[model samples]
Target: MSRFLFVVPPLAGHVNAAGAVARALLARGHDVAWVGPESALRRLLGDGVTVYPTGMRPYGGQRDRGARALRSLWEGFVLPFARFTRPAVARAVAAYRPDVVAVDQHALAGALVATAAGLPWASLAPQSMELTEPLRALPRVDAWIRANLAAMWCEAGLPAEEYVDPRFSPHLVLGFTTPALTGPAPFPPHYALVGPALDHDRPDEPDFPWAALDPRRRLVLVTMGTLAEDVARDFYPRLVAALAPLGDRVQAVIAAAPHTVPDPPPHVLVVPRAPVLELLPRVGAVICHAGLNTVCEALAYGIPLVMAPIKHDQPVTAAQVVAAGAGVRVRFGRSRPAELRAALTEVLDSPPYRAAAARVAESFAAAGGAAAAAIHLERLATS
Candidate 1:
């Protein structure tokens, strides 16, 4: 069995998907470990895996949408965080000496360190931002991104001419999505679209009141994922109002801090956090911020969505959901209660939406999830 180290970002959404594959590696009698923010990994992964510590700074400032969000992420967070974590990543690589390094796309330091050390590595692309090429229409912006990547490559003291795109490893790239939802987007032959790496046994999932879920009424899940906390506070109230009227036929599980939706109606169950993976099968539809992990997880369970994208790749994922006929897209913040109500009702009551979700789920299962990803990684490690 080979030693595999996962170099992940501090972000919950990215880490969660990688965790699934890491566990898969473990299940096959391989050694699996993580290198990221110590506290966050501990919180998300528990004591099952070894974690190498790294510094983390909360991503401050406004989480804008579209081009602004994309640009701001690279400039404000990704580059700076990469620079900050570079030394620590190098140290982790030196000490662990793994056969293969699985690097998250946003965690540039991992790619840099692994490349510098001449170690085998694979790309862990949990987001659709680059895979779908949302910025292709804007040539200058895309060029600017390329320039930044090239500059970062040089900064790692690697010869500029020999630089490979760190976001995509030449050996393998594990995409946490499928063409069923992404439409006609083309990917390279080396890119493995392994659908959602659903970790059914993830640690540290928040407690939920299972008894409160009414089997008679259709269940809907409302969540903004981990990063959308700033907007979720205000958004929760609107969600409460929108779903309240549907109580007779629908019971909703709103995954928010109790204080965010303190006075939810009797029919609504509001929790600070939820074991969403376990809850998806029981849900008829999902209302979410379109975080890739949540979106893929819902679709994997054949649950339609009412997506209100907040920032980053969410808008793209939400667009894909709509194009796939599996969900409705309502504007985040700009959407009023009535709009939310209609979107939610549409996904819940529409037979076509459920059928589309089930079809996507079929595609996901065929795409091979954690098991396929682990096989690819194992091959890359010993090839």
Candidate 2:
């Protein structure tokens, strides 16, 4: 059996996707291990899993939007993260001696180390941003990114010629989204759109008052994701006010930071966190910040969305949802209660939205998830 090692970032979402794929590989009787921040991996995959701890330096929170945010993301986090984790990843490779490494898109150090060690590696994209040509629109930004990657390669003792978009692996790049959700794009031949690797074996299920939800009303889940807790603090109150008008016709489940809202409306259920996979099936519609994980999870259950993109890859994901006819978009910062209510109403009242979401769901199912990713990685190792 071929041994596989997964190298992931400290971020929970990225780790979750990699962990799912790791679980799949283990199920196939292949030896699978992980290398990353021990805390993050343990939080996602549990303490039973084997993981080599890679030290991490947290990014100083910079709350910029648009182009500035993109710049900050690269300069502030990506570059530093790669440099900081390179030694740990290299040590892991030398000690573990895995046949192949599955590298998360954000964790460039893994790719560099694998290349330097002459090991086959695959890129695992937890989100769709890397699949699209994000830098095509801005040549200067593309150049800037390329220059930074080249510099990082040099520092890691790898040849600059070997560098070509660290976000993609030269041998194999696995995307966690279907073309239906990503729209028409010229992807490379080595890229496999393997859809989302959803974790079916969730060991811990949060206690949610399922019976408390109104059975008579259509349920709508309102969440801004984990990273957007600060943004949600401001957005949730408006969302609650917007959904208040629906009253008995529509019930809302808002996942907000603890005590963000002391007294929510009668129609709303405010929870610090909810079991999303458990809750998605029961909800008829979702109003969110268009996070890729949430979007794919919702579509997997054939639930429609009302997207309000705040930052990062959210706008791109929202655009894809709108293009695919699966959701409606509203302004995040400026949207009032009336506008939110209207958009939520449109998604719920329109049959076309549900139909389009079902189409994407079909595509997601056809594009094999964790199993397909494991097969591809196995082929890469054995080829």
Model 2 TM: 0.96
Off by over 4 Å in 1: 137-140
Q: For model 1, how does the per-residue alpha-carbon lDDT over 203-278 read when each residue is reduced to its tens digit?
A: 8787778988889999888888876676677788888888879889999888776877858999998887888988
lDDT of each: 0.87, 0.85
Q: What's each prediction's clash count?
A: 0, 0
Identify the candidate with maximal TM-score. 2
Top of the candidates by lDDT: 1
Report the C-alpha lDDT of model 2 over 61-177, residue by residue, as the tens digit.
647767676777788887788888889999999999999999988889889899899999999888766578566655676788888888887887777665666778889999999
